[model samples]
Target chain A: MTRRDSFLECEPGVIRLFGAADIGTKGMVSGWSGPEEGHNWNDGVEAACAVAVKPPVTRLMLSVMGEPYVTRARPAQEITLYGNGYRLGFWRLSARAETALLVALEPEWWLERGAKAVMRLMLHMPHSVRPKDINDGQDSRELAFCYRSMCLRPIAG
Target chain B: MAEPALLGDLRERPDGSFDGWCWVPGRPQERLIVDLLVNDTLAISMVAAIFRRDLQTRGYGDGRHGFVLRLPANTEGLDSEALITARERRSGHIFGRVLRAAPAVSAPGGPALDRVERQVDALWQDLDSARPPPEAERPSQRLRSAFGTLAGRLRAQAGRAPWPDGPPIVLPAPVSPALTVAFVARAAEAAFARIAALAPGLALARAELLVIDPGIDPEVALLSSRVRNLRMLRDGAAAGVIAACNLALAHGAGERRLWLGDTVATPSAAALLALARALAKAPPALWLGPEAAISFADVDAPLPPAVSLPARFGMALCVDRAVFAELGPLDPGFGAAHGLAYADLALRARLLGVDLRAVMEPEPPTGAAVEFAPASTAAWALFRSRWGALDPLIAGA
Candidate 1:
């Protein structure tokens, strides 16, 4: 008897990729567009998802593979990742090529906040742009970066 | 452009309860809050956020848009022929056709049910026959035998007295406990410490802690004497965790039972009370712990509302004594793989059309020092063999 609901909750160490018809909506909270061909675009200035990790995990590596929506008008896209309200890392993407953002999540960020089970990962992108506003296309939805996959693996000592 | 619509079915179960899935095709990600009405009168309200495998496979975003609601036994105007309908709580837009309640009926013992039962029994027999013969002397058993021989020789050479044997200690029956907390303890000292920490809360809720020790550790005997409301059940034959849990369940005197893991932190008094309240109001659903761990700092924080749980995620499970008795005991065939055993129980409940939900509450942080054993290969194989056809997403499959 497979508990169908467990698949809805994010499990630690399991890499869930976006754009899969079966599991693309696993941990999606808000600020994201519908899954596309091979990726999902962050819809607005902020996007968030939740994950549950084993309680003993003191540190983890948050690896996200995606491409920023950069154009000549906006040469760079600045992205900041936050775990349970604690800023984890920041990256600046200057090209439209796929970029992998790897951030080390320290214990203080999660353990200190009493987030032992589920950690909310919030991606803040102040530079999100709507294609229509930049004269690129008629699309009106605010888009920042499109993610292909995201993984949170525990860092062994 | 197509009109946005709620598509699903709301059927009355044989027990007069209602369960079904609903989602707006254009807004699959939105979890609709639905209301159940009996004869056009509101009966119950629930969030349609339970995942259904069929819904996912059929392209209903994530499939977490289902609900199972048990109406009160004495709900006004509810009868064998009452009209039941489901509608969106916000828009009051009704979904699906009206369903007439079915009279409660005893399980059918007809040919079809009997045939299914026979097939399942045959499958189990086939799996049992396929099991490989046990090794004559495993490495660990051989090492233990050698150590025992060396120790005996040393004792004889020194003319030391043999170890003393005494009858096993029996604990008095608890006086009508409201809840039973049971777990298999791999380490007596750590289990004792957890019990000590949880004693006050257990006492406040009139709960008894049943420690099932396979080793029958002497430390546990000593600790039981010191701790109030702590009961010890020695697994004298070293029967695995599954058997130990069944023993504890049989011997427990509580109205409700909490099957907990040794490494998971015990819930506080408030959390226990919350669970009791939820169980009282809920139908025969399997209540699980939150997906996230509750740390000491957040122990006093307000609990989130209960939500649907996937069967395999909880470290703790609470069920009414009657519900457990109805569902039957955990399958002993799982051996020491208690995790799979619990998941099996949940899945079995689901097969019987029971809801699987999580009780949101602040629980103690899990102990970091102890690492619980993973499920054995044989147990996993057996579980997959039994349930793989039903659930394609069996772990590692």
Candidate 2:
């Protein structure tokens, strides 16, 4: 077992870009949805950014579009970020993830599956924050095969 | 197996009496005791006999019991609201509830009937007049001799000038019978489109639509103008809905003013007319539509018809222009800055003794006017500063 404090080395602006989002008019996000169609998950995330992003957010690079949780159980550990010129790596299903993870809806479900990866996020600090213990509906072997190659820093004993 | 029960329809008799059937079938036909209550306080208890009809097609009970009560004349001059409560002799518990608010009348005939009679009398007098003019008078201008009143009308209009600021705000016009529907249009296109579609029905009723568009492009204003009887005002972006609504108030020349929004389902022309008609019957009131209205009592509880005198902000409301001016303009600060503008207006209206009334409809809305919620911390601070304590203001009112 490792000390909780030591396991996390936090920095300012880590969760600055991410925000909590509501269902909001079901796709009435700012000028994003097509004339006929309502907003989908991707558009919801971008539109929610207006209310979600914390202030001094004006200072940071603004991205209407962003990637959130797991995509095919790829671990989504290291994310290539842009605009803000800062790379944001998410630690999904971590012990302290509740405070950071945005709950788009109740009971951990999202408006759209892709929305799970857009609005809810937390910083990935290697082995300190572990992936979800339960099967995330992805092929388990892919997670096993991919995690082996990455230089995953182990938790201190 | 059998307990006391109040069953079936409650009907009223023309002679100011109530006729209804109630009985314990196959039981002893003895002293049938029942009570008739008016306004839930004035109770008139009576001993009745079983109304004989058991031998006919047997209904619920042995159709042997019924009562005809000659309700005392409304000499006390109380509002025609009566509650018919029947308490069984055996149990003494009121079995059912029946609410009736009889219409109040000015005279033997309705206002329209009286007006018609007056016009006919005038016409008869005009027909028998000694002096005959070259041209006949307009029916609308005079009750009798149209030719006699023609010169008077021309002289009146000629003497009167236009509004100092701009053109006269002509609402239902001289001939329009339709009610006027007015709303402040924000950035929502879906809301705007819905109102636009209702224009034809409104025109059918001779109603006019006044749309106030603030800080929007020229196209929105242009689109709204094409509708018949619909006038659009385009104020620059700096003016919020509160300011635009004030502008609409200035130009709204209807018999009564109705405030609505695109967020709500547009009521039918008949329903809108019915609402207007209802207000005409009651005392002058601020008719708050059943959307998001808060109770005068517990702010947390729903604004039930029984307790809530003047409901808080509902999505749509209708007020007379003369009455509205007396209440003063809605505070722009709460609306623009905190988004609590309607609540403030409601409170102020209550303070000024403006009766807040509810227009009943299924699925009442909470009147969340803005597109999004404002930051809570900032909103709360502003609300407290403007409204010192809510409980007392509500309690006092």
Candidate 3:
């Protein structure tokens, strides 16, 4: 079972990913599988994680580096990202290679609950599938993307 | 010297609205006047008169001592990062918690889209300026053109249908109607008959029924004469359900507006009275009723009051006219997919801190499931373009 306390900050604000620095599994609140050799797969249709941020910052840039579980049968996967409750951005990944998804978090979203708020990031992937259901493999866990890393950088107002 | 028994709290909602309940313990019957201060400056004052069942059940006089203040449009950009506090006017007491206002987010597409819109307008203006002027017509040609216009008008008039050709037949509205039942009649005569069946119940409850129809049904004219206070709107263009509902919203002469589908079972007079009472007492909210029949245990017994509806159960809704107008009219761009339009309105209401309540009856209405037209691809795309996929259930509905 994955726990939220598994996330660790490698530096002041940077969170390293995979192999003793797997922030994805540590910070994942729900909808995720165990860490793999060098990545973490987002299980099921939705995945959420909570990231703590220092106050007085007006905006934050969220960078999610991941690769979709695309195959010959599934040519592309669409993902919609949400911060708190507001939509941050969207992407359609067609290749298996890792891609960086960057979106700016406005003050309204970062400070939604209050001045000091935990930024909750959620990803919605409707086309997620179990490998066994598609005859691709015997793996039955619903997988959409394998996350390599995630970084949050604060931008001065 | 003891402190004045001031019992209440104020909290800021996610959408910047302020809601709280306050009453002097010694004077439970009195409704306190609360002043909202932004950055230590008084912004607005309101009477705590809205009802809250919790307050009443907890020993507050009548529960009509709560207030919900919607964020004023003018205060959006001005007080984005200010401290807000609610103070009782008479006692000079302030709420314990001071809320920090969230910065106002710009409209979905933001400033870049605004710039693009301006460029598109400029291009349209440039195109208009480049157009050639029309050639001056000779006197004989002008006379011939005038005769052609006259013949076309005459032909159009001759071919016009007798039923829905002219202006809509708007009968006299009820004097001081408590509720306005509004629905779009797409099935013409069948829809009109269903609405007409509710006329007697609506009249008994001092509710006016507004029917927006395509005017293609000739039977509607005769039915209109039979029903009292039945205002008919002829949507001759068949501008779809959202547009028709907007027309009804505009023409309805009632304190509260009930947006219903023609297929839903007609609510009894007692059920409508319960809805009206609940709406009257509660703060600004969208009250939703079950699609099935709403029957009371005794039919004559006191009906049950409405309760807060979970976000997922938001389907049909009723709203106060002012609140409905404040939230803005249904986007006619949704076209015939009125369900999506209502869902959009419900979403907006939720964002603005308006409660979505379920109007409950003693015996829960049962029977046939209510039918909602599946959203067209274009309508779904339009809705998604505005709201994204924030709520999957509402989006799918």
Which model is ahead, 2 or 3, in terms of TM-score?
3
lDDT of each: 0.62, 0.40, 0.61
Q: On residues B88-203, what C-alpha lDDT tens digit does candidate 1 reach at each position? A: 87678776333242233333333444455457556555654677335673444465445544543443333321233243222223335677778876555567656656666676
Best by lDDT: 1
Give DockQ per model, in order: 0.01, 0.00, 0.01
> With candidate 1 superimposed using the best TM-score fit, by how many Å does residue A54's alpha carbon deviate from the native?
66
Worst 10 residues of 2 chain B by lDDT: B160-169
**Interface RMSD of every candidate?**
11.8, 34.2, 24.0
How does model 3 score by TM-score? 0.34
Cα distance off (Å), candidate 2, residue B29? 75
Off by over 4 Å in 1: A1-157, B1-174, B290-315, B358-374
Evaluated on chain B only, candidate 2 has a TM-score of 0.44
Ordered from best to worst lDDT, the candidate numbers read 1, 3, 2
In model 1, pairs of residues that clash are A6-B310, A117-B292, A117-B293
Clashing pairs in 3: A6-A26, A7-A26
